[model samples]
Target: MISFSALGCTQINGAEQNAATPIATAQPDLAISGNSTPNTDSPNTDSPNTANANTASPSADPELSTAIFAGGCFWCMEQPFDQLPGVVSTTSGYTGGTVENPTYAEVSGGSTGHVEAMEVRYDPQQVSYEKLLTTFWHNIDPLDNRGQFCDQGSQYRSAIFYDTAEQQALAEASKNEIAEQLDQPIATDILPAARFYDAEDYHQDYYQTHAVRYKVYRFGCGRDQRLSDLWGAEAPSH
Candidate 1:
């Protein structure tokens, strides 16, 4: 197991120390208007652009492909893929929402139309899309439509945003497989790829930075145990 320190904590600096800081419980007031981007002074931290520049450089492997997913709180969703062998990077962010360049504050408000999502850049040659979809299913509660686990509202909805027709077909097939495997009908939505806005820097790698609190949140929310019950032998451990 990789220690938290070894996984990189620079992404979140002062967050852990202020773990007790009360995160705003009130949802922000946001109105989803068409496909228009939201007006905000939030910094632009495009993950794909950065990944294309950093990992897609001449020296890096060229077989990798990118996939975007929204499965509730991105903090929890990011964990499984981050541990996967062939995944190059997993960036936590927002997608499928109407508000453009939304902040954590805005998205949490339940009005931004954005679901907390992760942008996964991986080597498809190494890890198949089917495997990634399998990992995604194990990490989230597909039975819940009112958001995932403890988190409620649209921001936490489960969605698989496909980047291509092949991805779309695979996503649908995977969902069907799950539906047959489980007694409950799968509730995950298959949506087309939308403009994925990378979250603010502070929201990235939140679990690694706030390890203790994240553990508490995960445990208190019963996310892992629920997944274990659902996925049985396939569930990944913390």
Candidate 2:
């Protein structure tokens, strides 16, 4: 069994928290010059205003790029990225493990070496990777080498799974900047991209699907308070 005292919160894997009381970025617009076919790599560059006014031809822009982040519970990570302007979708999942198609039970068992993570599909033009990193750094407790917030265990450790050398450099640069800004040293890891296994269906869109439960868990766990304490004025509005 995991110890909650070490982290100062209840230790439950990805399980929903019990019901309780509730609680509660600048980016440039990219312009699309031509009618380009959308793909994962070639996302439409048009700004939101000119892109799509109707539901039928939404975005009229290119598909967005993706960034995977492992920061404590996937549920906590999803909402922040989802709220960002350029982020198209944030899918909670597992990564950095040797096992393939590992189930939640297996991962929670703590032997699979996988950390709960979120794959963020975002439009790079609308929101630069640097901005995303800034948003991410603010959301997580980078000083917690063991795990994030109230969660404790290797499975809950923080990490950035970079897909390219450029990404790696950007992540490292961001971490260094954070270190300079704060007195405490940051512990978030920077690693290469690993095979990301989509979590169980129930785990998908957790905040929206289980808004009440998520709010209680976040409040009781002290995620926002801790983040505000760490980031101060730099903290993003949640």
The candidate maximizing TM-score is 1
Which sections of candidate 1 miss by over 4 Å?
Answer: 1-62
TM-score of 2: 0.74
> Residue 92 in model 1: shift from native, Å?
0.6
Q: Model 2 misses residue 15 by how many Å?
A: 9.8
Q: What are the lDDT figures for the candidates, one per model?
A: 0.69, 0.69
How high is each candidate's TM-score? 0.75, 0.74
Q: Report the lDDT tens digits of candidate 2 across residue range 1-238.
A: 2222322223344443221212211011312122122222322212122211111111335566778888898878888888889898787778888776666656666788989888888898788889889878988999999888777789899999887789899999999988998867889999988877777655666666555445455665778899889889987665
CA-RMSD of model 2: 13.7
Candidate 1 residue lDDT tens string, 81-156: 9888889988877787766566565566677787888889998777998999999998999999888877767888
Clashes of each: 4, 4
